[model samples]
Target: MPRSRSWLPLLALLLLPLLSAIATAADDTRPNILFLFTDDQAPWALNASGYDQAHTPVLDSLVKEGVYLTNAFTVTPVCSPSRASLMTSQYGSELGITDWLHPQREPEAGLKPGTLTWAKVLQDAGYRTGLVGKWHLGLTDAMHPTKFGYDYFMGFRGGGNSPKNPTLEKNGETKKFEGLTPDILTNHALEFLNVDSDKPFCLSVHYRAPHAAWLPVADEDWAPFKDLDPMIPNPDYPKLNVDRVKKMTREYLASVASVDRNVGRILNLLKEKNLDDNTIVIFSSDHGYNMGHNGIWHKGNGHWVLTENPPFTKNIPKGQRPNMYDNSIRVPTMIRWPGVVQAGSTIDKTVSNLDWFPTLLEMAGAELPADAKIHGNSFVPLLKGDDAKWDNDFYAEYSTKHQSHTHMRMIRTSEWKLIRDFLNEGRDELYHLTEDPAEANNLIASNSPEVQSVIKQLDAKILANMQAINDPVLKEAKAKSSN
Candidate 1:
């Protein structure tokens, strides 16, 4: 009888191709990404964050189904810079985008061509990337989303848009739409999701709601808070007029309600399509906002005038001095990746928009360019419930030639925060959050040894961060001050 033919070699060759096919299928099963970004939203704006009056049922449910970050912040408090940091995963000072782009003045200031964004990385890795919302990073043809990494771009290019009868850009063509801007944007997002594609997708849906110019929302959304009297923050500053505060609160809450309802629409769509299990959904804001907190009506310049008469004066001198209060810099952030991130969990450690780039890239299993200079470490380990290696401190900076707010840097720990005005404006602030969570008391002028010690520690940290990022303001300001 002939020796038993060894089938091992033939079987090995046949199984190799089958194994390769299985690997390809596994790669194709990578999770889809849905990033939901909001404008000027604070951490406390949602009912999930303990705001009893906020009608944000959708967000509240999301909080229950995801990891809520109580200590999330933007690298800068302004719109363009904060959004830039999110896109680049670097500080605004490093990118030279320190203020909101003024079309006439800073027309040339934006993300330049060849800048590697997380979206570009994922796109290059075979994911179908789309951005359907505000693209405040830039407006020039070369700076458009298509030039960056987006296969589909449909939204406003500027910082904001009118809620009603707004005009939008569809891959560079301006189109007019009639309806609330959030709802309209959601419809466009759903349209993008419905596209015929077999590859994994990344969609960024940024909503321009609850930002500013708070107007009456749809009658249904406005009805819940119409007669409600929300509790407004009362810092040690002069007391605000109660009636005026209530009116602003009502309108703001109404706008938030509209945003929440629209968020529900997106969530429902994901469930209906059975994509909830493999889709990673993230919600956050560019930065925080203040309605009547700390005697401030809005963000940045924290000042408002209270009339002593029945009919309040409309022409209150707007305060031009910007502030670094938590209400302005700390934003609400959450992420939901089914079976990955623990449901109903909360992370108290400090995290910023700067970490988004590395985190997303890690989730996509893509490699960063060897020469890429990224300042943010991936927080994916924290999402997987490993906090032992997390950083508990955060640093931020804001610089502007805009006369209203100028060069400033801040360093914050869990219990203390120190802000220094690099221009020697003598408008510095320090707060011990453990004792004063409202930031009502400023300790910059304190002579207490404990306060001084904390300041010394934080000052060194701020300088280290500035040096690491090659902060131009710090370098220039030090030179000017020394000279």
Candidate 2:
């Protein structure tokens, strides 16, 4: 027995390699997700991501290495509500955040406090989560991203970080932590990726680039850094839009180009860590903006209006109007997941922000609560090269503070689009998108029987989502029209 003590040590050494082999197997089985989001970015900017406008060799490499979702949209235009809706897989009103209610309004008082969220669901499914960059969902301490299930938070809580924005970069890095704010966010994101933890992670890196203060050079707009500037204002832009004097279309483009460079930064990080295959990179915006596209500077909703900015703000006549337009509602979205998602794949089908929360779950094989109601259908099927039928439509409503009086609703199908202004005695219009991507014609009053039939189908589709918003807005609006 005394001689056997030497043999016991030999057996312990033999079992250590077996344990190490099991750990390696586990690492190979789990996938990681990197959510690359930018503020006020457009789908067109991605060409720089790798399609070649600015030679975003890294972003292009990601696209070449992964899949990109071609058509994607957000639930609302304003900041907080859009993010809230994106997290919960529901529209603003359904989630009880019917306005840009964070910095400006603060979330509604008596409502469901903690419905399931994207971060919460992923954490529950065992993912290590980190939220860096713009975290404007809720300014309240209780609503911080950490409360929503993120393990680490390195972003500003208020809306944005433009030098013009007061709350920009108070804490993340400056003496507290100083540097270019967007660059700070990107650098932190790289640090998060560099983390070599065993738990799978989700880095919600929301870059504040291309949103505003459209500065190109990192240090210029803030002083001691002017060479970082990239864009100038478009002087004759309004003549191009026909409504208001243009402000800064050229500057807007420059802002976008700057964001593209940051996008390349994120893509490059993924590769540097050798995590490209397991990470899912997505790019989109809160909603559309105006860079003289429709004779406006920025937007919160006004169609058919004579000016871009607010009336008193920019001196426009009372009751100047806006018709529901594509530039505002239709935006670009890209998704890239190597091997799992098709490379350079563009479904061109209409989808909404409500779908993002669930799609992430599907990617990680996580479970959604059976009782939870998710308005967005998973495009995971689309990304996987499966032709599973999707609703192929979107219903968007933004009767919020900026255009609250408008009470607008929109429904778009594969080939047709309809818009109804509920407040205007239910005035309705339809357009053949194939013939008019700009929605220049209102086919509602047309006597053509063929157009009426198409209108009817669009109406049915609208009714389905109206039921989602609440059957009454549509029922009451439609009833008002009939009378």
Candidate 3:
């Protein structure tokens, strides 16, 4: 009996080791996800996007090695709503986050409790998830990144942070990090990658660089732009402040250069850890930026960068030029999936920030919860370069409650764009996008029957989108139109 019992124990020990090995093997098959995001990055701000003045070598390399999405855009061009859409695949208006969360004015505003994010989905599906940098969604305990399914979070919970010596939250405590902000964030990202485990991980590195206050970068980043006068997107607009635009352009490009430098660090780390092949790297911005584009300097809620300004209207302030310009909504986006996606591939299909949720879930082999309500489709097939039927039409919305006032909704196609300002009368705009890529011409006043017919069809599409979301402004907009 004792001899037989000893053999049984030996067999049990051998089986335990084998089972553990099998489990680890299964986990290793799942790819690690590294999502690198930036703040206020314009699509043309990259060298890869043909802006030769922009020094984004690392990013350009990523584009060469992966898939560059030429027409990527965000649902809302502001920080909070775009982040919300990226996280949950829901529009900003639906989540009641139509504007950037102002820390002082809107203390209680945030992503509601129990909101299911893609991070949570991946966490629930056995992947260790983390978000590093810029969670502008909420500033309270209930809306913390951990609450949104991030196993670890290290960044500011507000709209802005200093580019140098930023006070960031880390490991349940706020710590002031020394050095340029981009470098500091990347250092921490490297630490996260150094983990010695077989568990699949999903990490988001959201850089606050290139947002604003774009200075104090490392000398290496600034050297290229130092004493270099950068070209303004529109230097000839009336009273355009060419000098001011040039100064800001130099500063902005320097800020973008800082981000590119840090990205190089992250990519090197991935290769060093031998995780390059097994990891999927994605790069994008919260939304596109505008530096003197259409004579505007900021995003969705744009500000006129002019020596003289437009007069104050019923809804718009004197300096504010609230708009739905393509540059404000379009973002720079790329994805590097080694084995799955072919190198140097380019996808011109229109995709929005909303698509990231379902796309990431599908990549992770995770399923969306039965009750999950999302407004985006998975773009996995597009990434794989499949000949899948795709839609180039999309809708965008922005309601600037703080800086300005307007319920702006847009319907954009390859040929035309229609923007309706529901709060203000006669502020509608229509552009033939193919002929007028700069959107310098507003044909909203045209009485041509052809133009009117196109507007009618596009207006119907916008209303349909609003109705589907049960947009809160729909009733008021309808009433105002009728009056």
Candidate 4:
């Protein structure tokens, strides 16, 4: 062979590895993200979370095959605000969404355009993003999910919807889907996943089940709980309606099972598509629910589930029990990262919905804008089981303007929790969480020096957190106190 020809073969040998690496790099799409979110799902709603009565086989399996976050919570325990915090990594107050948005009441209210969501970051980084199911943040066209980084959105922009044969928006058209709502939502989600694309994708499947009107579930979904007697959290509480609680429990678990079934379908599809290995599956809820827990039955703006509710107080209507209960804040959260997170692992560190924004950005290897401001730290290290510094202290706020009028701010540590209702006098509460995880004992008025000391410390921290965020409630509270 000529010298040139001989060198060509050697050169080809040297370039082969480089060419192969390039091909691999091109084919290595970033991990697809499947965020399955539920509405009004309590942290203990799943059997995997040790609630034996609940049938959530799919989610239980995910917990076994992934990292179960035992202390995952949302900053705000309402629909709109919690979701806003998840999208922006900022508190609901910071985003002007302190409560669930009412389409008629706040017709102009919606997520502000230009908000930097992790989805937008991922989308900018070449990932296809879609949101299916609920988008309660805003109702206007300007507040559409697509405006907040979703490439495609097929769900209601409002807070509530029927459980079956519901009307949902798809491809800019509001059409009625005939079937169980969860099944219908999952059907569209599967369609989103079936799209032929090489780009990585992020799909948020937000279910409105397990919320209210929790009925008319599929026969299979309802079969397990229909006739079964379920346990109530606290049947001995004053005026507690045991029968009502059990009935709601059965219905709620059935609704949750519907979500579980749909989740199974999604998982199966991911495996069938060979995307499971490369996809990150996260299951969580907008916020936790309370079904007769502490005699309350709702989310942040909870309602008294008593046979006879307390009389109407100033600003608080009859039956309304606005609160910052753990049952309303803590959520059932698990993430299955095929290779990164170890199977059957658990993280007890406190993480909030706010953290997801930065965690996902980091997960996608996407960068935030220089001017973006977020209030959450990335828990990616925790996900990887790395020994990293993690603060277990959590701060949360809820300013209910619709069902009730109150400014409830909370500071919770591993050992203690304090909730101060700034707007409602004598409504403050303090709990030694280490001793009373149920928050049954109200220690705010305790005479003990230790209890008082904790109250002072936690109250100060809550104020500091509010000040850090320039919470409007602080100014309002100050004015009210002076007046």
Candidate 5:
């Protein structure tokens, strides 16, 4: 061979290793993910979404700096099922976790040990995973966060506890904190962020706020809404007692305000550490809440006070039905990714908590297992301002047959929403959302052909979704109908 040919071979050998190193570094430059989850936060609770009653200055600022999803929803309105769906990217029916995981009754009900979560996937892809707040999925050793993927878990294992001076569990050890729950959790999350690690990190900071027993928030947090009579849904609904509604609203908003303050603290830490640019921050809730909306308080199977007295009475009648109303399922969702996701962008298309699984995995450059059956489509294209085709419909299921609520399934589109109570002898609810966004009117009794056609269409969609998820309730309902 000639000298020129030998020189060419040597240059190729040297450049090949350098090129491989560059490729490896580029692939490892995945963004760190910070997910901020709240409990019982309604879609309209944020000031950015037009609820001025809420003093969420930090979240509002995030809305301006991120993509606000106007129609985001949870697969189930309850905590465990919704959180399970978020982690597994599947419906609650598919996971057989239709109700909140209770410690005494269903201690073993949780994501299976071998289940694939976005966190686990990211961890497999070389990301550090940590959870610093509420983990309602399970309490058993086999169902623990560490059993699944998280390298660090420091939070409560049950549904919820008092926001003040609560006990927390960390790596098989339990300890009590002296400060507020949100503040303490935020401090732990900040500590997780400060952990010296070269690998990218994924931290989930779930807060128990604005849930039931909504008292004892710091006085400063309650000061903003204490004197203000926050707005209630469907004020004209005769069954609703406006006084009780106003009081609950004040307490709920105060809790939300506390959460907002802590959110600001987290955001400030990211900026202080100069991690804002490379961090993908998300803010959302487990599900929505109803503060006297459609004559209900709390979530699934919500009750209302019948009389204006010191001792309140629940107005539930025999065979009473709970509902999956918009106020109970729709949640405020926003995402901030510095250069990839456009700032101040709002997506009106319907999206679900399930979508987060696939979106985060895609963003982290993680591969989905071949056997993994994910029900959510990745919305990363939408975040990138691409002309992506998106789903316009949503499906939600809530099964509390063992609780006070009846089993409910819902299908909603842009213009219409249909809610079916499988166990209730009462009529289903059909609303034309364009004409009535508040969902105050039910057109289920209408005999008009157009109304019937829409109901039929939505009912078919619900059945199809049920079949897709192998819903046992649907099978039972079908058996009953056949008989």
Candidate 6:
């Protein structure tokens, strides 16, 4: 996770009891967390069924059993930085992890070998941790999960998975399978569970499905959907059915279906172990994709001002990319903590991937360090139906591919969203979700003063969020640069 958030003495001293009671040696308190994170999945694409054509049967069922947050977001919309944020509970700005698939292809990311990960905190406080699939943080062995508190480590270390070159490592031993992706990963996770029968563990089951280079699921599983959209698309952006695009989306769903089956398998294993009642299941994705939404193919790429070939993805200038719009940042958050959280409940409160850290900490009853600085706050209380006023806004930032001054930052609430960019005239984009739910109109600089007033409110929200997670280091650097 990148190093953003806040550092201060924990105000709630009473949380110690809660921590100890909930966390076992390796399984922290508040039910074992099974965080199922996928890549490039849109909230709208998840089991919308007739509304949208995506097969996520297992995820669909899981959402029905518990709470589904419609407005969940990621701090950064890309790969490495987003997961880093989840692991550390800090935004990339805080962690200094500004890019995905970091240029250095190490094992655990650039994170220090012995640095205490949020997982380490849980493991230290009494929880067994296991992470499976796509650890794209840094590539160094020192960044490996086993040393960082996870008892098990089996997955790859890149933005996308390669079935042919699938790298599965157990402890320090590694195996590269020239086979399928989900099969290899699911087997690795299953192998870990099969070996350790009794330890209460938190497994972060990451599926690189619905991502690029989409492939079909195992036979008999996705065979049902094979006919749904047999063709797949290439990596080209914005086209729904160009070349392999349709096939790719189909393959994406097939991959998702396979991942779902794995989820089912894992759940069955838990139930077999009588751990279902004591577990929490969360399903989400890092960011979203543009499947022909206004001719946008992928994310972070925008249409040019005049050359209208469609903007989701294009051969654009290196530094210029799309703004930090909600479509690319918003994701589905389906959580099930049976008996503790409401059944079939839908919470519209704005949440971010950063919240996962502190939420897990609070749930497990672990002690946060006095000097620990985290940007995210715990939403566990809200999940439990406690009427609390959580923040209405979540923040998102996106930097250009070339690391130029082309950057965008946004603050989004339920009914409104504001994107301010130094690149686009600090071009402020304002959206009134009440009318334009899809965020089509820019209310900023509109004719109506009332519409323009929302821009002011949004501007204020962005500044407040910035201050909430402001790092003195970065602020000093910015000030220095300006001077």
Query: TM-score winner among the candidates?
Result: 3
lDDT for model 6, on a 0 to 1 scale?
0.69
lDDT of 1 by residue, 1-483 (tens): 877769988999999999987876777789999999988787777999888889899888889999998999998998899988998888887777888877777777788788889999999988999999898988788889888889999998888688777899986789899887888999999998888676789999988888777674788899988788778777334656667777888888888888889888888888988889999999999988877776666665444534332232222134444778899999988899999999999988889998999999999898998888777888889899984677779999887556455677999888999998886566679999999988889999999999999899999999998888888877887788788
lDDT of 5 by residue, 133-220 (tens): 8888888888888877899999998997988998998768998889888888888989999887768889999998877667778788
Report the C-alpha lDDT of model 6 over 102-124, residue by residue, as the tens digit. Answer: 45443344655655568888887
Global lDDT scores for all candidate models: 0.84, 0.65, 0.92, 0.90, 0.85, 0.69
Q: Which structure is stronger by lDDT: 4 or 6?
A: 4
> Residue by residue across 162-184, what tens digits does model 4's lDDT show?
99999999999998889899999
TM-score of 2: 0.80
User: How would you encode candidate 2's per-residue C-alpha lDDT over 370-426 as one tens digit per residue?
Assistant: 888888887888878787878877777766454445556778776888877666553
Clash tally, candidates in order: 0, 22, 0, 0, 0, 45
Clashing pairs in 5: none
- In model 5, the runs with Cα more than 4 Å from the true position are 1-24, 308-321
**What overall lDDT, based on C-alpha atoms, would model 2 receive against the true structure?**
0.65
Candidate 3 lDDT score at position 172: 87
TM-score of 5: 0.92
Ranking of predictions according to lDDT: 3, 4, 5, 1, 6, 2
Model 1 pairs whose backbones collide:
none
Candidate 6's C-alpha runs over 4 A off are: 1-30, 48-52, 104-109, 112-116, 197-199, 229-247, 301-321, 402-405, 424-428, 471-483
Error of 1 at 91 (Å): 1.1
lDDT of 3 by residue, 1-483 (tens): 435565887898889989988987897899999999999998888888888999999999999999999999998989999999999999999999999999999988999999889999999988988888999999999999999999989898998999999999999899888888999899888888887777899999999989999998999999999999787777889889888888988999999999999999999989988999999999999888888999989889899999999899878889998888889999999999999988899998999999999999999999999999998999999988789999999999999898789999999998999999888888899999999999999998899999999999999999999999999889987787688
Superpose all Cα atoms of candidate 6 onto the true structure and report the RMSD in Å to 1 decimal: 9.4
